[model samples]
Target: MFSRIDRYRWSFQDSHLPEVTLFAGENVAFDQRAVRELRQMLEVQGTMNRWSSHAPEAFPEGAGLQKVVLTPDFHKAKGIPVGTVVQTRGFLLPQAVGNDVGCGMRLHTTSLTAEQVLGHQKALIPKLRRMFFEAGRNIPMNRLQREALLREGLLGLMDTTPRSLQEGLWQLFHDQDLTHEAEHTESLGSRRARNTLGLEDFLGQRDFTRDGQIGSLGGGNHFVEIQRVKNILHPGIAHAWGLRKDQVVVMVHSGSVSVGYTCASMIREHLSRLYPAGLVHPRNQLYPVPNAEVHEETVLQNWDALNAGCNFATANRLMLALMVRAVFQDLEMPTDFPLLYDATHNMIWEEDGTYIHRKGATPARGFEAMQNTPFRFTGEPVLVPGSMGTSSFVLAGLGLREALSSASHGAGRVLSRGQAMQGSTQDLDDLLRQHRVVTPVDFARTRPDVAREKLKELLQEAPDAYKNIQAIMETLQGAQIAQPVAELEPLITVKG
Candidate 1:
């Protein structure tokens, strides 16, 4: 099954760099651009294989890279492929995780049905706007509460923060027992992240506006969507996960926002100075902090900062979900919002003693690997969301060793944002009307030219900019990496 074909051949032969592996299903053509990028990565050092492989000269020397794996959604990113998974033995690559340190997806199953939300659409939007916008005044958090949440994650927030400050958020935190929700969240929404580097001092020197960002959804593909479970592919697992057909679920796709970017920039700057002079490539903005070269203290500092960022991201998603709950409360609807799972696709994890960097890829540990959690019988839930106005999936991991137990985070971008903006001739109103996706943008109030440009920006994120999600999901299932459990169709999408 793994026989080499002309299409799978590497562009250049190198003895030192490991051979690039392609995992597309039979009859499926791999992305040529990604293949070329991988080939360029092999030629860059001739010693260490780069992850992105786009601009070989940009990568620094002696990266200590061990392996590079591309998912079915592989596509060209700034320097690396969006669906690329990079493994390193004794080094940490900043760019591998990208600027969004803990950018990820979170889903909460609600007692409210699709009918309730769709019926209340007229009243729901105003309340949602009040909770999401208006300075995030609905969900208030003090400096101390913000620090605790950042330092400790969801568990920390529950244990330390005052319950009186934000009753809605507090109620949401205790909606289900911490242990139950923690089992669903990656790293339990916080791994008791210790800050030894005084991130507080650094954050203070910067803009340092944690309260405002907590419940706010960041832009560029980030959204809080109301979706309906259209179909249950695996009935048993769906039942076990408390999901049913026609049930409403709130899905939040966001990240650490400015907090994460700030931490990543700081870490990148520190690591950049340590790069060997000639090793620094102008095109390669990524730098790896190898354990061998850097002092133990510096390594610890970087790790601490990264952990802090990850914790902040986890809390940020939780806060965003809580904000959604607040909207539900304001509308006096079914208030039970039990968390299904929270997982990060853009981050690094220490698995089996090797650091695996997953950029736009979800960790799909199978049943055996999740013995301690409720998913012991079923694998961890792998959420693969689609572009706006499309179907999203909930999958169970198969833990394919060849694919590093990872799946694509979303439908990989086929066209760049700029390209989509330039080429898009989509009729925004008609498209939305066709899909019945309610957005906050009031097209009627805006000027015609400005509205057209805004519509282009919206079209840039339309389904056309992405690869066929059905194809991507099929590729994952064909490769035995994950199997779809449930399919969700978006009813209402809230974007920044």
Candidate 2:
């Protein structure tokens, strides 16, 4: 369905459909149906035609899909490919952004070396399991703090002083690190929560209490991994980014947990209600909310919900990093885990009057776009993690406008979770043992029933479930979308 335009690019051109550009190698395959569904989102029958003459004003001039680009990890997902990047004028497609509003990658450079972390593995693994899986996530936030997080994310939390819990986990925050954290975080890791829908329980309280979802490493591919810098692909950028050979760093892959899904569901329901009566629904079931006067309230509410959900997600990652710090503290190791960069791959960005929706795609802006941040000299740090038992890469965004300044989020899933579960469990065990990956469960100590369930989860996320990350990196570099700075090998991995 696509013609190879170059070694790393493919173009699907149709006179009646919007042109799509896919960035991948021959080894990567695309779901034909996903490409068709993507085309449907841009055509007359797909979206604009669904609006009734009952509301002609809703159909504005020059309002439709504008551009589409897929990263190397392009694969089938609900409605669109996982690595799809689409830009639209005068409208927003929440489905393109997906349920995980601010789900993204966060990287931290630590002072310890791989030898230091690995040396403590014997005593460290159980503590990690206890803290991450058991009742050890003790992050307590008052209603005000939660409200600030919802309102302005990390910036809001930094501005507000916690009146309770000045010791222990709360000590992770310091005035000196506050501004530095914001400076390194993508977009300051804040979004204005204009509307707080379905979040009543998380707001309006003066007392500090712990919530289950805030500091959690949610299921699926989400994880907290301690990695060692395995190789330095670009020594100049690696040194500039404070990455050294064999240095230990923490990589967190997570999102807003239930908070993000709740907001996404609300937006979807709102769109469903606004859809014109007696019209055929979009074939892919993907809906778009127009940015028009008639739909002003709906649009505003959506933006607010998106911002709030994203705020929660950013806070969730920060809390998770602190939890990791707590582990280091108990081990009497250095707990200063300075954030290298925190960025969201799944979100919407308004650029030059166009909404760029990225699902499992990272914002890879060049030095010019990042002039205000510390990374202005080197460009944005793109954190692309691999599947379990693989090496992750730290790349610098080249910010090529041709690709909408985007890159892949991970070595995109090759197999569905169901398909991955069908893989051999013994293979997963061997890989875990070989790679020295530490999961939350101790299969030998756990009950057979519980072990089986945990093993299922493990098998679903096995490294074999994903494409070759080395190939993905090659495609990325060959396409000139991003340049690899350093490669990291996982030393200890904590999965929920």
Candidate 3:
């Protein structure tokens, strides 16, 4: 059973596992199955004695679970819940980060106004589809550039790609712009990668290659939406972030698709190989790699794989933003899309000495953790995207230690995929029209069969599938976890 510990937090405790605190409102329902799975996963900690542990001098604290916290948008995922945060010492849980490593949100404040972008909506929608869905995106990268990006993230791209190569869509890779943009991004929006699994083709040739994943938004709730500032909750902070009333902003929600999946597969396979010969596998198929002398090498390799996928995901989001910029340029809008911030919701972060694994949860670091970045005074820009056709928000992290300095990634799903699919197609279409959202699927020219298939797919992510964004925001504020800087209303949404 769960009890309301406070206005912002609900507490659940099992005798066999650590207590889980969820930051949510009174209206949100708690998933008991997720809590049970979490307890079961934690119970495996007792079985660590089965594996031989050489006293790793490197990790003095050894390996053990430390804390578990759930964000306001917490929901049941496969084995772990989305919007969950787990902190551990001297160990790394591969399943904690899951397969979608580096999946996150990116926001860019544009020079154009709502009036300017909306006025051209009729003419701009097709252009956006052509650039995003069609083969109109021209991003050229040689093997060196590709390897650099996969190995070292955006910094690697800037260091290796020359001025001459930065043409067409590549022009957005200006050194100055990248440098400035990095200053605002979380952890500088990059991580050094040592392994490039399943990326041989893109890394074999010396000349430019046309890779499909770089600029593509992968499936399942990933989107690029154009929004206008709906309200200023914190004028001082909003102004600092260059947000104003009715100003247009572009938000991209995506992740490392094939690259992340491949990397995850390789890492999990290695874990399986390391498993002791006569032991039964964990029922949930989740494995945790302890920081021991015997497992140190494997841990390093796992980190390398994780970092590679993360770098690829970061680069992927960057390319998506540039694609949007290219579309605007094609329509004669000024190419002044300054990046507000880029932050990952799914990844592991090493803080001080503990490892914090966040799945569908964003880092809401306060001033101290962000002292060196442009957000030093305002704290990290926590981008919480709402559901399709709902109001999203930009919040400033307050760095609450009790909450492990984290916030929700988006409005959590209210209905399961199966339940959402059962809704009427007409209601889905009506929601899309009511919000003025544009999708790549052109129903006007497509055959009835094709349109039905597409509509079926889109119905799963309808706005009604998510919780109330206003309630979520209220919890965040009431909890003192993060303060809202501004609210964004969708102008046009581009779903993949």
Candidate 4:
């Protein structure tokens, strides 16, 4: 039997539920359909309960979560609900951090104008394809990465696995200088039991080191978009970012893909074991294991792996950009190629060596801010990607607002991939056309199931599905921890 706690319009019937409370105020309201959808997306809801903020230990003395803000796009994800900003006293949840480890948008605007792209696209298609193909062929992995155990393979990707797979092994044999900063996983949120989310389990679902994942836009919401730098929200900021309206820019969004799934899968097992047979909760918030100190070594190992995984994620985009650049050169487009910003959505950081978990959120750093070393910075850029056929915003961090200096990761998904695939194909196609988006390949190009899965994610993430970003910006007016640099509009979308 489990101890029960009750609260108004909510209850901590589940132990885990007691750990969290949706701060839905009078303005916050959800229809039954939305509620049902959210509950379903929260895959583990049946095992957890809900409570208000005033409830017991949910809001500990010092949690990064000073406030919980949900937009119209709010939905459920691994453990924490998407759009949920959590500030824990001292911990991080790998699931909340998300599967696409270090998955964030990187935007680059060039000096070219629109006439050049529209005129040369016919000549540009082959070049773009070749770029992706070649990048898919060669992706670099460091020594530590060689050993991390997370790589990928597509059925097409798998058959063509490059000899690079053995390069890591060869390096070790040759005694080369390929060392990496290991990932540390121990933290206030880590459970005492072994983390099932280790790379040992999920590494090979796809291999970037090989030909499997490189140049490949993996399944689900990830995409590479060709956008027009249509607007500069803040002139001063835009100048700093080197962006100009009407210029062409490219945006790439992807994460650890299958590798991340395995890491989180392993951790889920740990959470399951942490809960005793008789113990039950309305919810299943990540239960950090006891004897956390002892797990420090293991935690560091996991953290290092996660960090390197982040490096992999970065390399993923870099390789793709190299292709984009090659495409531009092939078409002789005048657009320049420069990495504006690189950020990660799923991550845990040390604030002065303390733990900070950021899930479905990005850092909203300002020009000057002090965040414990390795952290103190004038500000960091925040990449906010919108729906594939919509607009993406670029902002610089201010500092801390509610808790951690943070902002929503994207238009938080409102539906699950399964739910998103429900609309008619024609309707989705029409929507894209209306948005002026030209997908590189049509729906037929994707596996029926994979296409549906992506559609589901797209539906949940459609521009209409998110809160008006401009309104969000208005809400944060003066809270300019992140000054708007540019407003990017999508032209072409490549989703795999």
Taking the tens digit of each residue's C-alpha lDDT, what string does model 3 give over 336-382?
78899999998999987889999999999998889888988998899
User: Per-residue lDDT for 27-138 in model 4, tens only?
Assistant: 3233334444334434332222222132324323333322233332355554556554444333344555666666656666667766667677655654554445334234
The global Cα lDDT (0 to 1) of model 3 is 0.82
The ten-residue window of minimal lDDT in model 4 covers 180-189
Could you tell me which 10 consecutive residues in candidate 3 have the lowest summed lDDT? 51-60
lDDT scores for all predictions?
A: 0.73, 0.83, 0.82, 0.51
Query: Clashing pairs in model 2?
Result: none
Question: What does candidate 2 score in Cα RMSD to the true structure?
Answer: 1.8
Relative to the true structure, candidate 4 reaches a TM of 0.68
Clashes of 4: 52
Ranking by lDDT: 2, 3, 1, 4
Is candidate 2 or 4 superior in TM-score? 2
lDDT of 1: 0.73
Q: TM-scores, in order shown?
A: 0.88, 0.96, 0.96, 0.68
Question: Model 2: runs farther than 4 Å from truth?
Answer: 29-33, 36-45, 50-54
Give per-residue CA lDDT, model 2, range 145-180, as digits (tens): 788888889989877755445654677765228777
Q: For candidate 1, lDDT tens digit of each residue in 181-232?
A: 7778987878555562545642332222445566768888888888999999
TM-score, candidate 2, is 0.96
